[model samples]
Target: MSLRPNPPCLNPQTPPPPQSELDNIRRYDVKAIANYYRRRPWKVLGRALEVLWSFGFFLTCLLWDQWTHQVEYYKRQRAEDLRELLTKLGPTFIKVGQALSTRPDLVRRDFLEELIKLQDQLPPFDNDLAFQLMEEQLGMKVDEAYREISAHPVAAASLGQVYRAMLFSGEEVAVKVQRPNLRPRLSLDLYLMRLGAEKFGRFLPLNLGHDLTLIVDEFGIKLFEEIDYLNEGRNAEKFAENFHGDAEVKVPCIYWQYSNQKVLTLEWIQGFKLTDIDKIRAAGLDPSNIIKIGVTSGLRQLLEHGFFHADPHPGNLFATLDGRMAYIDFGMMDQLEPGTKETIASSIVQLINKDYLALTEDFIALGFLAPNTDITPIIPALENVFGSAIGQSVQDFNFKTITDDFSELMYDYPFRVPAKFALIIRSLVTQEGLALSLDPNFKIVEVAYPYVARRLLTGESPQLRRQLIDVLFKNGKFQWQRLENMLSIARSDTKFDLLPTAQLGLQFLFSEEGLYLRRQILLALTEDDRLHTDEVQRIWGLVKDDFRPQELVNVAWNAVREFSLAGVSTILPQR
Candidate 1:
């Protein structure tokens, strides 16, 4: 993908030209270009000073070996200072810090903890400038577009501020007005960031597994998309379509007539923040159910819909009075390719079944391991990490331990998380943390199991069906233990009907390969001399109960007759 500059829009009233026409357009923002050159020196100096100050503390701690005990204290202090510096640097750096908070591979836990608190809340821009931009972009006066508009912003953030307004038709809406000259400022900042990233990749001790240039380029694209209010409006519409008729989730409707490149008008959702458990409970709502709905919806986006809300923090989510999850700020969204989704679903199944070998294969398939890499070394490591949780219920499993262990393994192995996978992990971890705060006993896996199982049981994917069969059948024979575990998990959810799963299994059994599998089971039963009479009877009873088809029953009878004849001959003995 080439990184061509986006053409400047000379007239905000007209729609921006498409990518094909960008090269033909000669529009330019001379003011933005001059401003960039004027501010470049000061911005560079400020960043240098901030970096020097941050590293100065660390160097002092290192050189003064006598103050070793204070090393940790100084390290924490430096991290806090770096976070403050990023916050002070403005919108671009704040976003960078927010992205860094999600990357456990790049930073330590203390730094991550501090960086995650970097809020995007900023003081509102001048109200007059906001109103003027709205009018200029929407090609209408503020009053013509809305019946009533707040003189002050209802909420202020890094890139935009939202005002409560009523449309001309009396529909209450939220108007998000972009920060003045954000496009030019962001372009300049991202250009500098890209240069810095290239330098860091050359000098820093990091193994990113990919080009830093590409990563920065991708980040720049996403940031630019976020600043495009029309893009955000379309994202909201896509989400609304995705969740149409979903009673537990709600997406704000967009008013396109009053929206433009720099100004977005959306249905204003009146609800409490998701973290306001006390207030939610006061309104006769169950916080646990709310979290459950959020988890399920998030899982569906990842596993079923392929598109997900990448930033689902408390601020971006709300618990409405109608008991539906209202998601706002559709600026950051991630899409999972079909192949990635398949790998994820298969990984979940393998984790549930405790299939370490299959899990290793999944990692390899997902590009976490090289194709030529020997997975034998990793299998024992996986066992060491997940063995304790093998037979435990989802509620009893420790998700933190798994994540920690995985982090450790990444340090030891050739594992690198792609940007999309990283976002998915970050979103889930953040959501899980929120859910835990709401209900200490909440188990994310417990809520996600039904969805995973439903996909495996009913999905049309042949690869997934093969994985399901692999989970249920081992060594060419049906594994009752694994089957029972799956059935138990399925039964745990009252809404999940096991009939479809049973039918799927039976359909497979009656297939040609399944007939061969039946023969393998018969051979195993007949050849095992340790089987006593009672044991044989129990096995026969189980087979008869499960395999109702006459061909299967006949095969079982023949195997039993041959075994009995062999037993009599052995007892009569002469051999």
Candidate 2:
């Protein structure tokens, strides 16, 4: 609530009492501003220039509506321009772009594709400046700390620049040195965003949770954590620990003694980015196989383990010499709260089974939809695209298909994805595209299906299960009830207006509308006869042929059997 956060401890974590010549230099109180700004008025005026640049953002969006067609054709161009502008504007603005890039649900495929280019591409800081910052943060000169520091930064961005370096023992490492002055700039940028979101809130829509306050707060937290490389160090360590014995995935070990708020030192890993098909091939590895490993492992992290890398682009992921897949940059990791992981897992399973009702419930549980909205239309809308039955599931639907469908649908209404799980969800969805790039037949769902099935059968983290139930009841209840009502009408009435019945059943089968009704049918029928699809279809035909009894037992049996959910819940992953 205040401009300043209270120190995490009674005594703050800062440089220890100055001993060496470097440490003897005045340490700027991280909590207190340095004299540079107050001592000089020009710096204050410079901040004003930044403020104007921040306000200039509206000019771009003003043309957003006008450039509709151009936006599509020139997506890459527009996104690169935006990324450059974001970088120029600094971390707060870059943060906005980064967040938007990871949300394919809220953006178009091309747009998201273009935005990924921003992740590791900011102009590098002067190597001399980086050396100075490293010395300032580590309390030692460059030579005192490392045997050889690459003056040329291997990677650089808003908060830091990474250099390939060698420690005293000759171990090669990568060092991330924070910019000389970052906190003040970030705070100001955040201030501008806060002011902007507040101004925009007067017309903010309900579904977006359009709380600029919350968005700004989250950004602040992320930015602060980003600067504190120590936390990132821990995250990488934890991830490495998780996959310790397994050789398929490797997270670089953190060199903690040299890591601090402004400088992070870790083992430098050698590999090619996941997207570089040629390099992966040149390394005597199958790009397709590596893609498989990336997708499946990512799914396990999000839906099973509840922790994941927010950005899994090629720049942040790679295939090591031994064919081990490695993930880097823990600066942006997302942790699914209780129920989220399960909801996502269940949603995928439901989609695979073409259980619209299950997906609807899952959506509701995950808080993607309101608990009280009419789900009749959405259910049928899904079936219109995905079809209904066990084999013809949404999971069978490929990434390109989803991109096409969601792209059109999103134009009308922003397909809602919860804010907290935004990064993880988008990463998984984009992974489909990355996989398809290497091999045309690569289906992210196919790759993820085995892990999904394994988790479902073995039971997942509690968070995932909670989310599944939430979707079924919390958000999809009305649709379920409506489905129940439709079935009840068809069962009891002599005059069966079957259009409403079929449509209602279809919608209920596909999404929010029939989630509960389908669940009810499955639980009820499974209890009675183990969910015979032929029987289900036979029942459908019986409802249709009740008046015209033309010896249709065989047809009814066949249809129900074909439609019976046999092995629908069964996982099919061609691993």
Candidate 3:
């Protein structure tokens, strides 16, 4: 983790951007600033202020060198400052900056730490402006735009603010207002990021071989899509439609005519967030049931359907009075290539089977690790960690102990990954933290097993089965040979090191051997099915399948629907 103080290539000047890359500046709408600020002079003043503030902060950091402090004072101050500023900047800058902050490699640690502090405390936008934006977007005033609109904002986010409102058709709705002049300000920030990267490459570890210009120009285009309210409004509409029929969850209906590039109006939902324990209790709902609802919705969004909300924070979620979970914002959505989802399912299975090589390969495919990096040391490193995890299977494993060891190993020899991939890791880590907060004894693997098993049954087709068979055959043979070798070693006069080999062997056998443990799955489809099969596969192994445990519940629901209509025993008569 320590950098050589001044490595030869480290301080070299970045190569100049190609002319074609330079043309990307055109994608930025210079005039959008005028529209948002409502005057050319204010746009100029805003840019000047941004420049002055940035330079002043940089100069202060460099000159005085507040080198020592009681408790990381500078880092804390920076974070607090970022939180305040994002709140002050309305919405667009907050959103754009957050996406940047998630890239630890893109910004320095002090700033990233500070930006993360903005997570919950950014100030809400003016409700009056929210109404004005609604009028502007729909080409009518608030009274005309909706049947009823809640005066209060239910949630405020980096990109926009959400308020509960109702349309003329008697539909309750949530209206999101994009801060005025956000489009132009974010474009400037994108340019500023390029400048910072080129000028300060040594301070950051960007993608090694790519030109700074190309890297940032691509970043600009993506950020461009993010600030566009129109696109975000569309994203919301599409997701609302995707989950429209689901009863356990709802994506608010979008009011497109009342939505524009600067505003959005959708169905309003009154419910408590998943993390709002007191409110959840007040609603007379079980926290466990709410957890299940959130988990199941996330599974459906990510698995059966590839499109999903990139951020699933508590603020973006709500639990209804009757117990259904509500999803609101959709400004940032992530769509996985179909294969990536498959790789994840198989990767978990690989982890269960302890196939470190396939696990490493899957990491590469999933963008969890650097491509072309030496993975040999890593394979052993993982074996040491994953082995400890599987000695009792994922269900029985103590993740704190296992992860501490894994974290130690990773800290010792870390690998680089893309920012997008890192964000996914961040989400899982955050979710795990939330789960532990709810109950320290909670095991994500245990909770997630049902969802994984369901996906194994449904997400995978016969092609997946063929691949599963091929992979399992190799892994099983490998395990047999490994068991034989260990046995052979055990007979030797000298006791060999089974610790490492045993660990390595365990990972391989689980992922490979459990590939098609269908009978074990049927057993775990519910608590009552325990004796349906004499043999058992570890629940974690079942979780590793392309299937999700939630899918099992879905199957049950469909069966119930069938029974309500037909009165049948597709409902599993007995154990």
For every model shown, what is its TM-score relative to the native structure?
A: 0.78, 0.68, 0.66
- Give the Cα lDDT of each candidate: 0.71, 0.62, 0.57
Decide which is better by lDDT, 2 or 3.
2
Q: Candidate 2, 200: how far from true, in Å?
A: 1.9
TM-score of 3: 0.66
lDDT of 3 at 559: 36
Q: After superposition, how far is residue 53 of candidate 1 from its true place, in Å?
A: 6.3
Using TM-score as the measure, which candidate wins? 1
Predicted structure 1: clash tally = 0
Candidate 2 at residue 252, lDDT? 81
- lDDT, candidate 1, residue 382? 85
Between prediction 1 and prediction 2, the one with superior TM-score is: 1
lDDT of 2 at 201: 64
Model 2 alpha-carbon drift over 4 Å, by segment: 1-83, 99-116, 204-207, 372-378, 385-396, 399-416, 460-575
